[model samples]
Target: MEKLKPKLFSVMKNYSKEQFLKDVIAGVIVAIIALPLSIALAIASGVNPERGLYTAIIAGFIISFFGGSRVQIGGPTAAFVIIIYGIVAEFGIDGLIIATIMAGIMMVLLGLFRLGSLIKYIPYTITTGFTAGIAVGIFTGQIKDFMGIEMGAMPAEFVGKISAYSAHISSFNMTTLLIGILALTIMILWPKVNKTIPGSLIAIIATTLIVKFAALNVNTIGSMYGTLSAQFPTFAFPKTNFQMISKLIAPAFTIAILASIESLLSCVVSDGMIGSKHRSNIELVAQGLGNIFSGLFGGIPATGAIARTAANVKNGGRTPIAGMVHALTLLLILLLCMPLAALIPMPALAAILIVVAYNMSGWRECLSLVKKSPKSDLIVFFTTFLMTVFFDLVIAIEAGMVLAALLFMKRMAEVTNVEGWKYIDEDEEDSNDSDSISLKKVPKNTLVYEINGPMFFGAADKFMEIVSDISKDVVIIRMRSVPAMDVSALHSLWNVLRICQKHHIVLIFAHVNEHPMAMLQRSKFDVEVGLENFCPTIDAALERAATIKPYKK
Candidate 1:
C-alpha cells in the first residue's frame, strides 16, 4: 500500500526562506483569483455570499493541509452550482449541510478502501456529457441575474426555469443589462491587458464602484442578501431526521462522486504542470475532511478547483504550503474586506459565472465526439447530456451508466465467437500456419472447434448453441484465444460435457488460457472430463483424440 501521507510533510524537509516567499506570492495570487469566484459560485448555488467565503476559508485550508497534491487549491466550484442549488431549494440550507457532510463521510470511506482508482472507470463520454450539461445548467441559471429579469422565485427544474423566464421576459431591466454587458466586456478583455490580475476581480471592482457612484438601478448583493458578514462562520450542527436522510442520500452520493472526480482531475492537472504524482487516495481523504469541516461551519460543498489549482501552479506554487497560504489569505479578506463585496452588482457576478460556464462546457470535445466517436459512445454522451438538461444529474448518470454497460456487453458478445475450422487440401497444407488444425491430422469421426474472446455471460448462450448439435465420436475444444471465463460460460461447458457423455463421445481440451484453466480446475470440470484429455496445444489434443477409439452409435 502507498503510504497515506500528505504531500506537505515530504516537501517541508527541504523548505527554505526563498521558497516560502515564492509560495506566499503564489498563494496570495491564487487567493486573489479565488475571491470573486467563491462568492459567485455560492450565490449561484442559492446560498448567502458569506457561506462561500466560509467554504474557502475552512474547506480550502483543510484540503491543503492534508491533501496529497503539492499544489491543490480547494474551494467551492461551478460544478456544484446546479446540484447545490437543487438541494437548497428542495431541502433548505440545513438539508444542504447534511448532504454535504454525508458526502464527506462517503469520500473518506472511499479513500480508506483504496477505491480512488475506481473513479477512472467512469466512461469519458459520461464525464464529458455531464460537464457540458452542468455548463448549460449554470448558464441557464444565470440568465435572470444577467438579464436583470424581475421574477418571484426561479424554478429548480429546467423546464420550469424556462417557463418562468418566458413569463417574466417583459420585466427585463435595461440598466441592469448594460451593467452586465460592461462586466462581461471587462471579463473578456482585461486578461489581454494584464495577465497577473484576474479579469473577474477587475470586473467586480469596476462594476461595483460604477453601480455605487452612478446610483444605477441594478440589483446588488447588498440589495438582495443584505450586509455581508466579516466574521468567520460559527460552527453549528445541522438538523437531520431519518426521513430527510433518506430523501437526501442520493444527492449526497452525487456530491461525493462529483467531488471525487473534480478533485482528482485537478490533482492530475497539477501533477502534469509540476511533474509530480499525487496520491489519489489520500487526496480523496483530504477532500472528504474539507467538505466535512465546511459543512460544520455552515458552508457549501467544495472540491479542488481546477482553474485555481492551475493558477497556483503557474504562479510559482510548488508545495502544499502555497495552498495553505491561499486559504489563510482568503480568511483575511473575509474578515476585513468582506463588507465591500456588498457593493458588487449581481450582473457582474452573473457575468463571471457565464465565463466559467463557457470555459467548462468543453464544446469542442463534445463536437469531436459527436463527429468522430463510435455510435455507442455518442449514444451515451447524448443520453447523459439530454437527461441532465431535461431532468437532473443523478438520473442522467444512472441512465448513462446503465446504457453504457448494456452497450459494452453487446460489443463484447459480438467479439466472442465459436468457430469450426475448414481444412485445406493436402497439397496446399504446407502454407498453413503451425497452429492451424490443417497442419495436424484429424481422425475420422472427430471434430475440432475453437472458442474466441472472453467466455462470459454475454456469449454463453452462443457457445452452447454452437456446440449443442455436435455429432462427433470425439470433440477437440480449443481455447487458446480465450482470455477469461465466467460462471455462465462454465455452466454452458458443463452442459456440453453432459451432451458428449450422453452421446458416448470423448471430449478433449486444448490451449485453455490461465483464467479459464483456473476456473475449470476449481470447478473440477477437469476431473470430470479426465485430466489427461486437457492438452497444452492443438497438436497434443489431436494426439489424445487420435488415441481414443470411435464410439459406436
Candidate 2:
C-alpha cells in the first residue's frame, strides 16, 4: 500500500525564480523542436496538422502537472505512426479516437494496479524487434509524400501501396521533390549552426520562402489542405461496434505497450539527470490523463518524448514548470500563428517525417546488433523488419515474440539434458556423488531410480521413458539433480505418486534440493510422497528402502 502512494501532483521544494526563467527558455526552444515534429507525426498518423498542436497543448499540460517526472514532455511520437495510420485507414478517425480513449483507461488501470515496475518483463529483443519494424513502416509510408508520387488513390495495404507507388513512378513532381530534398538537407545541417532553434523549423521556413518567392508549382499546405483555421479544438464521441472493437484491440494494445515502455524510459532518463527517482504508477496515471485529453481534443495518441526530456534537462529546466511552459508556448503559437501556417509546404513536412523515421530506425544500432549479436537475435530482428514492410505491425510483433520464445526454450533445453551415470566425468566434482548408494544383490521386486535435471514439463516426460521397464513392489525415485517444478510438473508428480501407491510400490523422493523441497512443502507433496519415504540423500533412501520391502502373501 505504501509503495503505491502517488506523488505526481506534489510541488517541488526550493523552487527558484531563476530556474523558472531557464525553464521558460527551455520550454520555448522545445516548443520550436516540437512544432514541426508534431505536424509531421500527425500527418503520418493520418490526421490534420492542428491535431498535433492540440496534443502538445492538452497531453503536454496534463503530463507536466500530474506527471511524476519533472522533465518529461508528452506528445504524439514515431512509435504511434504505423499503428495510428492502420487504425484510421481501416476504421476511420472516429474509431481511432475511441481506441485511444480505451487505451488511456487501460494505462490508468495499469498504474493503479501498481504494474508500473512490471513493464520491464517485456524482453529487450521483443521491444527492439517491434520498434525497428515500426520505423520501417513509417519510412515506407512517407516515400510517396517525399518523392511527390501520385497514385490517384493509394491503397492502405503494404504490398498494394508499394505496387501502386511503382506503377505511378511517372507522376513524380520535380518541384515538390526539390523542395523535399532542400528541407531534408537543411534540417540535417541546422543543429550545427544553433541548438537553441530547431532544425526542422529552419528547414520549414527556408523551403516555404523559396517555393513562395520563386512561385514554384510545388503544392503548399494551402493548395493541398486549404487555408488553416484559427479556431480552437473541439470534441466528439465515436460510434462503435463489435467489429470496430475487435479490429482496434490490436492497435490499442500496441499503443499501450509502447506508451508503457517509452514513459518508463523517459522517467529513468529524467531521474539520472535530476537525481530524483519518480513514482512509476503515478507517472502512468498522468500519462493516461494526458492521452485521454489529447484524443478528446482531436489529437493523435501520445507518450513521454525522450529527446524533449533530455532537452529540458540540458536547458536547466529541473521542474515541471518547464514542461507546463512548453505547453503554454504551443498554445500561444496555435492561437497567434495559425493563419500563417498556410505558407508551409507539404513536401517539407514530409521531409521532417523522413528524418524522424531515420532517427527512430536506429540503423547504426540495428547494423551493430546484426554484426555482434547471436544469429538468433539477427533472425528475429530482420524477421520483424520484413514483417512490418510486407504485412501489419500486429503480425510482426506476434511473430517476433513467438520466434524469440522458441529460441529461449531451445537455449534452456540445451543447458538441461540428462546423461547416463557411466558417462559422468571421472575427475568432475559434483556434490550429487556424495549421495550415491551401492546396493548389492538387490531384491527382485525392488527398484532403484536416479533422476536428474529440472522437473519442468519439458523434462517430466523423460522420467516416464526411464521407468517404462519398472514392475516392482517398491521403487526409490532419486531426485538428485532436480531443482524446480512448475505447477504442471507438480501435478504430474502427484499423479505418479498416487499410481505407485496403487501398485503397492513404496516410493521415495531422494536427494531433493532445498528449493524444490520448499515447493513440495507448499504444494503438500509430502502427503503424496509420504513423510517416511522422503529423503535428503540416497544413503537415507537406501536405509529407508529396507523397511518398505514386502514378502509375498
Candidate 3:
C-alpha cells in the first residue's frame, strides 16, 4: 500500500520557486519536442494526428499526476506503434478502444497485486528480439509515406505490406521523396547547430511552410485525413460484444504486458539518471489509469516515453511538475494550433518516424547478443524476432517464454547432481577447506549421498534413483547445498522415506536448509522420519545412524 504513494507529493514538500521555474522551462522544452512526435506517432498508428495530441494532453497529465517517478514523461511511444496499428486494422477503432480499456484493467490489477516486479522476468533476449522486430516493422510501415508511394490502405502484416509497396513502386512521387530526404537530413544536422529546439519540430515547420508557400503538389495530413479539428475529446464508451471481448483478450494482454515493461524500464532508467528509486507498482497503476482515460478520450495506448523523460532530466526537470507542465503545453497547442499541424507534410512525419524506428531498434545490442550470447539465448532471440516479424507479437512472446522456460529447466536439470561422499586425506582437506566440505570416515553399514543445486521437478527423478538404490542399514542424505525444494521434489523424498521404511533402513536428513526444513515440517515428513533423525550436521547424522539398532531382515 505504501507503494501507492505518488512521487508528486514527496517532491512538493520542499518545492521551491527556483525548482518550479526550472520545471516549467524543462516542461515547455519537452512539450516542444513532443509536439511533432505526437503527430507523427498518431499518423503512424493509423489514426488522425489529433489523437496523438489528445493522448499527450490527457494520458500525459494523468501519468505525471499519479506516477511513481518524478521525472518520467508519458505519451504514445514508438514501441506501441506496431501493436496499435495491428489492433486498429483487425478490430477497427471501437475494438481497439475496448482492448485498450481491458488492458488498462489488467494493468491496474497487476499493480494492485504488487506484481509489477514480475515484468522484469521477461527475458532480455525476448525483449531485444521483439524490439528489433518492431523497429523493422515501423520502418517498413513508413516506406509508403517515405517514398511518397500512392497506395490505398496498407496491409497489416509485414509481408503483405511489402508486396503492396513493391507493386506500387512506380507511383512514387519524387517531390515527396525529396522532401522526406531533406527532412531526415535536417534532423540529422540540426543537433550540431542547436540543442534546445527539437529537430523534428524544425523539420515540420520548415517543410510545411515550403509546401504551403510553394504550392507544391504533395500529400499533407489534411490531404490524407481531412482538416484538423480543435474539438476536445468527449467521454465515450466503446460498444462491444462478447465475441469481440473474447477476440480482444489476447491483444489486450499483449498491450498490458508491453506497457508494463516499457513504463517500468523508463522508470528504472530515470531512477539511474536522477539517483532515485521509483515504486514500480505505483508506476504501473499510473500507466493503467492513463490508458483507461486515453481510450475513453479516443486516444491510443500510452506509456512513459524514455526519450522524452531523458530530455526532461537533461533540461533540469527534477519533479513531476515538469511532466504536468509538458502536458499542459501540449493541451495549449491542441487548443490553439492543431489546425496548423494538418498542414505538415506527411513525408516529414515519415522521416521522423524512420529515425525513431532506427533508435528503437537497438541494433547494436542485438548484434552484441548474437556475437556473444549462449546458443540457447541466440535461439530464443531469433525465434522471437522471426516470429514477431512474420507472425504476431502475442505468438512471439508466448513462444519465446515457453522456449526460454524449457531451456532454463534443461540447464537446471543438467546442473543438479547426486553423488556419494568420500573421505579426503587430512592434508588435502586442510588445503581445500573453504572450497570443499570434507567428510570423516563413514559409519559401517551406512550409505551417504549429497544432493547439489535446487531439487525441482526436473531433478527429482535422479534424486529418487540414487536414494532408492541404496542397500544399507542406515541412509544419510546430505542437503546442505540444496537451496530449495519444490512439491515434486518433496514427493520424491517422501517416496524415498517410504522405501526406507519398507526396507527397515534408518533414514536421516543432514544439514537441511530452512526452506527444505519448513517443507518437511509442513508435510509432516519430519515427524514421520522421527524428529531426532534430522540432524544439524553430517557428523550428528552419522552419530544418530550409528546408534540406530541394526535392521533385521
lDDT of 3 by residue, 144-192 (tens): 9988998899998999998998899999999999999989999999999
Best-first order by TM-score: 1, 3, 2
lDDT of 2 by residue, 1-553 (tens): 4244334345456767888899899888888888888878887788787888888889998988888787888888888888788888888888888788878888999988988988886666667767777877787787777888876755666788788888988999988898999999998898889887778999999998998899987776677667676667887766888888887888787787788889889889889988988888888888988888888877778899998888888888877888889999989999999877778888899898888888887877877787899988888888877887677777877788788878776665556554323223345545554544432323456677666667776555555543444466667776767777667667767777777766666777677788778888998888767888888766677677766658453
Ranking by lDDT: 1, 3, 2
Please give the range of 10 consecutive residues that has the lowest summed lDDT in model 2: 417-426
Task: In angstroms, give how far residue 472 of model 3 lies from its true place.
Answer: 1.2
Candidate 2 Cα lDDT to native: 0.78
Question: What's model 3's lDDT at 338?
Answer: 83
Provide the overall lDDT of each model, using Cα atoms, as 2-decimal numbers.
0.92, 0.78, 0.90
- TM-score (all chains, Cα) for each model: 0.97, 0.89, 0.97
Q: What would the per-residue lDDT of candidate 1 be over residues 1-553, giving only the tens digit for each residue?
A: 8668999999999999998999999999999999999999999999999999899989999999999999999999988898899999999999999999999999999998999999998999999999999999999999999999999989888999999999999999999999999999998999889999999989998999899999999999999999889998999998889999999999999999999999999999889999999999999999999999999999999999999999998999899999899999999998899888999999999999999999999999999999999999999999999898888888888899999999999999999999876555676665546777667778777788899899999999987654565567888889999999999999999998998888888889999989999999999999999999999999999888888887767
The clash numbers for all candidates, in the given order, read: 0, 0, 0
How far residue 159's Cα lies from its native spot in candidate 3, in Å, is 1.0
True lDDT of residue 247, candidate 1: 95
TM-score comparison, 2 vs 3, better candidate: 3
